[model samples]
Target chain A: MFCRRRNFVVLILFCYNNHRERFEKQLGEVAEVVMKAMELPELFAVFLKIGCLAFGGGYTVIALLQKETVEARGWLDNNELTDIMAISQTLPGIITVNAATMIGYRRQGLVGATLATAASILPTFILILVLTHMAWGFTDNPLVRKAFTGILLGVAALILNTLRKTGKTAVNTYADGLLALFTTVLLLGTGLNVALVILLAGGLGWVKNLYAEKRGAKKHGTD
Target chain B: MALINLFMVFMKIGALGFGGGYAMIPFLEAEAAAHGRVLLENYIKVIAMAQVVPGPFAVDSSAYIGFEAAGIPGALAATFAICLPSFAASVIISKFYAQFKTNTGIKALLDGVKPAVLGLLASAAYIIGVKPLYELSHSLASLTVLKAFLAIACGYFALTQKRVRIGTLAFLTVFALVGILFF
Candidate 1:
């Protein structure tokens, strides 16, 4: 037993001696990144860039966020990002913004959350403001009007495309499909408030789940 | 008063627009129509612009709606209001993530909300598309038919194409050029 212990200690010393330089270098790199991620300014800058480049659907930004936070800077790992993403979905509002806020809050607190959220939306806000101004100026020109007509068609097409993608994931059951159809009819055919309609649909869903649970419990008791 | 109303409407949207961006469209359209401040045509245009621009769709739509209702202050107010729910929710969730993540009630609610969001998007699409499709002229030479054709073609490509961002921008640019020269 003593000889075995001596051999194990020799192996440990050999490994330590061989990899000491690389180990220290890795530690220094990790420390630098930890510092960078902890700083409020750095957090703002990263999220700002993320906002500026996060184009297309909300899902697209998730990849970019993961890339920036997990792959590039090492501030988070895959699992932590996944958790943030899952948490973001549970709350109201944009997933990307929610994610930014969560990550910032985790690192720094309310101020960090505010700063990160602001940075994420800043570029888009300015761009939209500028575009709106330009659109106002061009509203009267005949050619611009013609172009807008075409753009309107494109907008319709875009919405339909979104519908297709969202429906694929959301409508997994017959009840879910029926719920969607009911919503479409109510929103299109009635004067109901959109928020109220949404809440009503949610209530129906809750009731459905509750009923299903009761039935399952009854079946178990019978068994 | 206009700014306050705009802020309130968007705050509601932010608080309830589960699944975000695309889901917020119906709420924005309905609220804007309720006030009759921003025209439906204009709101659709804003959606198109939002698609091409960088950042979240919700942010762009709120900013445009605010700008339409009350200029710069309106824009700021709407933007801040729409974002406030997200900010507040994140803080709350950060505090209670463990419990929130496991809550079945919230899960079931979201399950219902998801399908309803799909429905909302469908209704909004119908509202936006009816005008162009209904007005398509019979003449082959007219731009309306061409516009309809191009829109469908663009949509088809948008669905199938791998590189969405560049493809979308290209399609829009082509549609614009076709509009300019054909007319």
Candidate 2:
């Protein structure tokens, strides 16, 4: 019975991975054909759906956006979505805002982007407000304090998980590796501006990419 | 605590917030310390609310601080201010994206930017993780080690990426319940 139960758990995980793989395959094949043009109300509604329910912060919601736009809605192809992710990360704020702004702008226009931004934050704004009210009394309460600590621990785990996943892909080449190392040191070690660090790092990458551009052509030669 | 000052503080933080939500933790903490506005105990609540809320942690935090400082209007101001830089950036980038989507120069720039983001995540782990995990827990004597270990155990599982987000939240609730019951 234990063996059967364990197998069932494995089966469920397998099915989920398989489902994701299938979605990815389809996304690759058909991403180019359909371009969803959503109106203001429709745009607001879609973002609202994501904003209200999607938790665990910005990076966590990237996958949700991928599912909603690339897989389900076909608002953007996988390539465009990848581009958006990269761009969003490079920009400021959070992944949620950056992603929403890019996606909304791409699908609609200025108004579309504004609507998306508003929709994305409205849930959080209201929610924090509610929690703030509840939070007042909970401070001296030992139970809630202990619970908060526990939750913070869990949050730590989630962040470390994301860091690992992102690091796997982000730190690829020798230059990239060095860049990652340096960035980790600089940001943590010094009071240097984060924005300046980003700008300078991007500058370095640009130079490296330029150096590699010709070599890259020779290596890949297909593009 | 003028609304404008609230907005400006957030705007500056927003500008500096390059890595992501968690990466901005130190900046927020500093602002809290410098201003002496949010008491440490209350700030725990800020962090709590920041974590539990649906948006980015940084954004949620600013809203929390804003509300703490001023009121609903302050919250609105802070929220609006933080969103300003990113929104403007998005608009500018959107305009240029089409013209430069495939441009080698733009691609190269973003390429360099990517790894640094990875670095930020590393720092985020240290900067954000230390406070609640070690600092706060140390104050308690009984079962401090056990509580810390429980957190570590959950964090380890969380790293497995098996439904990470909701999984973390689930584990948090379960651990919280356990904490309530046991410790």
Candidate that would win on lDDT: 1
What is the TM-score (0 to 1) of candidate 2? 0.74
RMSD of each: 8.9, 15.9
What is the TM-score of each predicted model, taking all chains together?
0.80, 0.74
Give the runs in model 2 whose Cα sits over 4 Å from its true position. Answer: A1-38, A58-82, A186-223, B37-41, B133-150, B161-166, B177-183
Q: Give lDDT tens digits, candidate 1, residues A154-210.
A: 656776777777778788879888988999899878888889998888678667766
Q: How many Å off is the CA of B32 in candidate 2?
A: 2.7
Q: What is each candidate's DockQ, to 2 decimals?
A: 0.48, 0.38
Q: Which pairs clash inside model 2?
A: none
